[model samples]
Target: MTIEWKGVMPAVTTKFTDQDTLDLQMFEVNINAQIEAGVHGIILGGTLGEASTLSDEEKRILVKTTVNIVKNKVPVIINIAEQTTKGAIEAARKAEEDGASGLMMLPPMRYKAGDRETVIYFKEVAKSTHLPIMIYNNPVDYKIEVTLDMFEELLAFDNIKAVKESTRDISNVTRIKNRFGDRLKILSGVDTLALESLLMGADGWVAGLVDAFPAETVAIYELQKAGKIKEAIAIYRWFLPLLELDINPKLVQNIKLAEVATGIGTENVRAPRLPLVGEERKTVLKVIENGLKTRPELPDYKNSDLM
Candidate 1:
């Protein structure tokens, strides 16, 4: 599948069973829901998917499962958050072998690599695979920003196609467009900044809350792109509270709770990350409940050719 590198590409969460096994049934349910809701692509084993906890075999299974589930209707992108250059290269090759359409790679995990090291790591991984890559430039969480200088150096790799812009500085979208001039596709990685980023010329959104509210998420992107600004803002205003959940430390749990509320998923996460509880749970649930109570009737943005 040729990746368009645009539209609502969800960083979907991985579902688990009570015995702590991959719940393939529920995973399929969510993936189908995302596709039916008009998402352009699906990303597996991302932060929201609990990438660090997953073994290499488990990640491979996810790639195969998503590739099979989407059936080439949308690209299945696997996230590579390895601790070493060798590990990242191996994972990239494995994803391509497992039938992934592309990769969403972060800078080498664990030890923060400097500018030169980061560029080299990404370049080596790029050289190792035929798959196009989207650099996860999230300095705020990962602590090492892939600055413009590094991006300039990286432009030599034809496979380095896009950036998941999570820097949270909305202006960075314009800066990237100015610097690269459409050479690199920009997807807003922050849920809270999604609409603004899209309006400011982001190519797409690598979304978090879309796991549960796939239609609403897709609607916002489609409406914005169709030039229906007023209609998009109406839904985005209602979605703001729920979208903010993506920024929290417990976002996975919060979004899982949402999936439960919507009957699309379960709250069964892996260990070291328990389900939300007490006031945290209550507060999060309150937001979800309120959003549900007043969920807006979506416009027929799907009929627009922008999709």
Candidate 2:
């Protein structure tokens, strides 16, 4: 569907201190850089941001910090998802009260079985908040399959405006775009499939790599929007490999490491998630180096660049 949101909105990470507390300063620093680089939008408290581990206070800080830093320059969607419908609604209500532009909500986690029960779960959460909600479809991470029919049913509610589809199945992107094309906002969740999804009629994407390289993300969208497919493809090819790491359980640390490697943001992460080391760190660094070599104009690694 034609809508106000589109293109390379990174699932922004929440920076933290070694003590595992929220690093509000670095959060502002990173968010401001993404905004200045011209991302189509910004997302706070998404999976890539490790929203699962953050406390309610921390989540509130994330929403307020992001909304203030963005200052309405681009769309800022807050992830208001929890294990309970009440918690999710509370988070969504808080984000709305704090002035977030939109909300991306995940299904209730920590449960098992039954599609009918799942439907009721969604119905309850949907009823709790008035904010525009993007139903997150991420079975890979959450272990719950939010089916196409379920999504269609959710659409009966007027506030369910968008979706983050990440089944790792590109065809579903086409399916959602085709089936719900007239009704919901279809945002391809995987960064690697941004190109395919775009051509397949997805209105936009929520990218993980955009955290480390907002300029490149914005460039790909701009190039394609200008009908420069070849240029856009080049950018996508360079990012596809790194983007795949978003599927990795180590996504938060991986993107943070990429930030450290490129001076985009801190590699600082909360525990029990340790910093990457040994072969893992080496592998991630190589990806960053090659990505930089492929596009040197994409800002050199420098402290000044992050701010």
Candidate 3:
């Protein structure tokens, strides 16, 4: 499957059993739901997918499982959030070998690399892989900004093809467009900012909450593209509260709770991280319940010829 680098590509959560093993069954269920809801691609082992805690072997299994499940209907992408350049390269090569169509990579984690070092790390990894890459430019959360100058240097690499724009500054979408034109595809990484970013000319959405509400997420993107602004805005307004959960510190837990409410997933998270509980869990659940109760009837955006 060739990655078009457009449309809704979910950064899906890594499903785990109560014993903390990969729950391939539930993972398949969610991936199937995303594809059925009209998402463009599957991203495995991302921030939402709990990349840091997953073993290298587990990540490979996820890529392979998604590849088989998606069966070439859509591209399966793996996220590389390694702490070292060598590790990142190895992960990229392994993902390609595991049949991933593309990669969504973060800047070298833990160590805050300066501009030169960051660019070097990305270039070296790009040099190592044949697969198309989407640089996860999430300076707000990751703390290492891949500024335009660094991007200019990275422009020499043909495979460094796109960016997951999560800076939270909506204007960065236009800044990227102005600087690179169509040289790099920009996918809005922040959930709450997705529609606005799309309106600002982002090529796609690297969506987080689509794990729970895939249909609503895809509808917003498809409707916006089809020039149905009034319909899109109606859903977007109702979706804002649930979308806000993605920006929280406990986003994985919060979204998994939402998934549980929707009956598509479980709330089991690997430790060091745990499932939401007590008042916090109650608060998140209220938001999810409200969204579910008032879930809007979607127009036939999927069948729109305009898209």
Candidate 4:
């Protein structure tokens, strides 16, 4: 299947049982909600999905299950974050073999590679699989900025198709458009910047908090695309405090808290990560509660068939 690489693709949180096992039943429930809410695609094992802690076998299960549940209703993309180039290639190939529609790849994990090494890592992985790739360029979190020059090097492969632009320098959205002119499709990776990125020509959003409020997330993107800027901003402003949750260090915990309040997912995460508690938990829940109180009456919108 051809991945469209556009519009409100939630970096879905991986659900786990109390025993820390993959909760496939609850996962399918959440995925069905996303589809019903009109999300364009499903991304598994992403940052929001706790890719860093998931085992390879677990990741493959995620990819296969998502693909099966989605049933071609949307593309199922898996994230590949590994420390070694060979490991990255193996993961990418595994995603393809497991029936993923695309891959969202980060630069080599842990050791921040220089520009040269990063380019080589991406190109080699792209060479190893036929799956389309969305290069995740989030210097603020990932520490390796995929500069336009580096992207120029990656253009040799047609499968290296899109970018998840989380540089946090919003102007890079414009710079990417100015420089690449659709040669590279850009998806806003930051929730707070999603509106600005769309206005500036980003083709889509790989959202975080969308896991909690799928209808509002899809509505904002659809309204913006339809030129209802004022309507879009109203929802975005109401959403800002909660959207801010996506950028913080504790995003996974924060978002899961929102999910539990909204229903459809659990707050249980793996080892080394705990559910939010005390004032931190209260503060996040307050934001979600307040947002819910005034939640916009979302107009019915269909999923973008922009592909």
Q: Please tell me which predicted candidate would have the highest lDDT against the true structure.
A: 1
Report the C-alpha displacement of residue 221, candidate 2, in angstroms.
1.6
- Model 3 lDDT vs. the true structure? 0.93
> What are the lDDT figures for the candidates, one per model?
0.95, 0.77, 0.93, 0.91
TM-score of 2: 0.91
- TM-score, every prediction: 0.99, 0.91, 0.99, 0.97
Model 2 lDDT per residue over 73-166, tens place: 8877888667776676677778878777788877777876367777777777668766677778888877788898988788888878877877
Which pairs clash inside model 4? Answer: none
Q: What is the lDDT of residue 169 in candidate 1?
A: 99
Better of 2 and 4 by TM-score: 4
lDDT of 1 at 277: 87
Better of 1 and 4 by lDDT: 1
Candidate 1 local lDDT, 211-290, one digit each (tens): 99999999999998988899999999999999999999999999999999998999999989999889999999999999
Clashing pairs for predicted structure model 1, backbone only: none
Overlapping backbone residue pairs in candidate 3 total 0
Model 4 TM-score is 0.97
36-73: candidate 3 lDDT, tens digit per residue: 99999999888889988999999989998999998999
Q: What is the C-alpha RMSD of each candidate to the true structure, in Å?
A: 0.9, 4.6, 0.8, 1.8
The window of 10 residues in a row where model 2 has the poorest summed lDDT is 298-307
| Better structure of 1 and 3 per lDDT | 1
